[model samples]
Target: MPSFWSQKSKCLYFYFSGMMTKHKKCFIVGAALIIITNIFTVCVVKLTQDSQSFCPYGWIGFQNKCYYFSKEEGDWNSSKYNCSTQHADLTIIDNTEEMNFLRRYKCSSDHWIGLKMAKNRTGQWVDGAIFTKSFGMRGSEGCAYLSDDGAATARCYTERKWICRKKIH
Candidate 1:
């Protein structure tokens, strides 16, 4: 009887050992997957940071925010209204890159910008919580257009797509 019990114990030990060996492969695979996922996450973060650092179109990309030049014909009131409706504001050039991008499409004739005369007429800007500072200003051009030049304010009504800038989640 003692011999029979010893034999059963040995068999149990051997079975457990074999099962552990098979589980070793599973453990190794799981560890490898963890390492691979960590590496992939790091790479994705780095790539996103790089893209944000330098805007592809010379526009300033700041803290998940992007601005574009809008060249559409609209009155100051309408332009502000439009931007507000879209949950954005008129183009604001926060840095040199943004300024350069906007200048590239400047018109020979002054174009309307997000800025407007303050109600007091004291040269102060009147804003409806859209923008704190005027992004840019135009001279006597009641209408706006998206152009580097060669287009008049009257042509702004030609129904061209405009630039819209917003923040990324």
Candidate 2:
């Protein structure tokens, strides 16, 4: 026959083992829930950030910038004035991607861009971008336009459609 102390020791060992198993299961479940919740939170935050970066209607969004192509034609000065009224400026092409975007969306007619002569008569953009001469800038008058073959210069008084651009807040 087993001694009373020996039976009590076996009962205590089995009781502790069963309790440990239950505790382990609860810990694993709690950890999994926490991980899942964190993943869901991260996904939601990314979605909201993407949506916030979107531009308003009628404006095209690209890399934190918004572009607007006008349907009306005007002189370069008048086009610039129009853009100012909209709290923007003539489109400034900073890279080939931006240039391509403008080219792809521009109307069949030429569109006035931001390039022009500075007060000192050197090439400059209204937004103060460095003029790198990516296009064949012709004419003594220095007002630039987005032509089918690339960028070209014409007199500021020439009538053309215009592009506007602004940074997305």
Q: List the residue pairs that clash in candidate 1.
A: 71-145, 71-146
lDDT of 1 at 67: 56
Predicted candidate 1 versus true structure: per-residue lDDT over 61-155, tens digit per residue: 55466655455555555665676776666654445555456556553434443433433322322233332333343333333433454122322
lDDT of 2 by residue, 56-133 (tens): 688888878998889899999999999999889999888888888788888577999998965454788997877886
Clashes of each: 2, 0
Query: What's model 2's TM-score?
Result: 0.65
- List runs of model 1 lying over 4 Å from the truth: 1-24, 41-65, 93-100, 107-110, 118-121, 125-169
Identify the candidate with maximal TM-score.
2
